[model samples]
Every structure is written in C-alpha cells, then in structure tokens.
Target: MGKLLFYIFCFLAFNSCIELNNPPNIQGTWELLSATTIRNDSSIVQDLENKRMIKIINQHHFAFLNHDNNNGKDTTAHFVAGGGAYSLVGNQYKESLEYCNFRDWEGHNFTFSVFIKGDTLIQEGIEEIEELGIEQKIIEKYTRVKVGRKRNIYATPLM
Candidate 1:
C-alpha cells in the first residue's frame, strides 16, 4: 500500500503543476454598438442610426455582417459580410480574413487589442491597406447578445 500511496501523491503533484492556458470565453453573438475611425487628418464616427451589424465568433472562426436596418428602403442601403479564422492570446486578438464581399480586403490579417467588460467588448486597432491607400485607427465597441426563452430574431443561422 505504500507504493500505491506514493504513486497517487506523485500524480497529484504533477497534475497540480500543469497550467491550463485557456483563452477567454468570447464565443457568442455580439452586436456592434459603435465604431470610430481616426485618420491622419480626420476622425469620423460611423453613423449607425440606420445600420445594424453583428459578429458571430466560434472556437476558431468568426463572421460578421452589416447592413441597413431598413431592409434597403433608402438609396444609401448597403450590405457587407466577411469571415475567417482568428486567434486570441490574452488580450491580443488577430483575425485572418479569408473571405469578404469586398475582394480587396480578403487575405489580410488585422491585430487588435481587445478588452471585455461584462457584456461589452471593445477592440482598438490600426488598419492599413497600401493598395487601397487606407491607414486608419479604428475603435469598435460591441455588446454581447443575450438570448432569452424565446428565439432571438437577430440571431443568424450558423452553417
């Protein structure tokens, strides 16, 4: 019985030394609350009054969709969508965009500093595309979507 006790103690000691490096639990549906873009000579706050945007994040992949909330009634109606793989190390989040409706933005990687406070998530990062002549710092805020007993109309069907 002495040898069995020694083996058990050793197993417990080794298991205690092992650290599980699990990333933050960000897998869910999030809605964009606000977005601000800063350029060299201008800073613009995106007009979200008539727009709706949501992001869906899983274990290793993420997708986003944005469109006019009015169902394309206005002349300025727009729609955009993209999705790809992402990695998160602590507060540093990197997204590898593989598919986008805007072809020019595909295959680009964007790194952001992410902070989550309760139900709100804020991401700040610089976006630069040489071919597009765009270099801007963007800060985006999102709120986690809570699904209640009834089905949420905003929840998109995940394939």
Candidate 2:
C-alpha cells in the first residue's frame, strides 16, 4: 500500500509540473509603466514621470524604445532604441541585439526574468555598466496595449 501511494503521488506531482502551453504567444505592443535601475549596492535610479518608453514584440523579434523628451519623432531627445531576435522559455526571456543606438550593444545576447500576468508584464535584468564599473539591475513594468488603440511615437515603438 505504501509503494502504491508513493507512485500515485509521484504521478500527480510530475503531471502538475508539465507545461501545457510553454512560451506563450506574446506578440504585441506594450506600454511602459515604469523603468528603474538598482545598483549592486541597493541604490535605486528611477525614470522621470515624463519619460517615454515602449516595447514591441513579434513572433521572433522585439523592439524597445526609451526617450526623455517625446514631443514627436523629429525632436525625440535622449532616444535609445534596440531590437533583435527574441525567445521565451518559461519565465526566462532572451534577446539578441542585432541593431541598437549604441554600437557596442549590438551582437550581444541578453537574458532576463519575465512574468506576464494578465495585461501586466514585469521584466528584470542584470547588466554591467563599463563606465560605472558596477553591476546594474534593471526592472521594467509594462501593460499590454490592445489593438486599435491610438499609436504614438512614444507609445508605439514598432509603428
């Protein structure tokens, strides 16, 4: 009886661990709610309230844009844009930077933590800033933008 119960427990546990839908289809636009950076020593650097940010993901590609002054595309100062191939495995998200504003960033693969709960998406990543010579942790929160919404320069990165 003990062995039979053990086998039943194992079966149930293993079945629960299986992923019915691995790597969900998340090909759409996302509006950035917040972008914050935390230093290795626990110092936090947050983006200003007026800062503009957006992220767009397709079947196998993704794009991200961040700017401070987003009056329009013509005069978007402090603009930073990057995108490339992307893959999601469980809670892990990885991207290859094929093109970006910073030349040094291209051809690099960045992997980070990602969680999509309903319309909200949270991502956390760690990067080493060469200039600062310290490790920086980046946390970004976003909300999925449904279709037919008004797309603007700051909110729509792909468009």
Stretches off by above 4 angstroms in model 2 are: 1-12, 69-76, 129-134, 151-159
**Alpha-carbon deviation at 132 in model 1, angstroms:** 1.2
Residues 34-136, candidate 1: write the lDDT tens digits. Answer: 8889999899988887788889999999999999877988886899999999999877889999999999999999999887777777889998889999899
> What does the lDDT read for residue 49 in candidate 2?
57
lDDT of 2 by residue, 13-118 (tens): 8876675336655678987876678875676756545566779998889999877765655543577899999888877888889999987778877778887777
Q: State the C-alpha lDDT per candidate.
A: 0.83, 0.75
Number of the predicted model whose TM-score against the real structure is largest: 1
User: Candidate 2, after superposition: displacement of residue 143 in Å?
Assistant: 0.4
Clash pairs for candidate 1: none
| RMSD vs true structure, all candidates | 8.1, 5.3
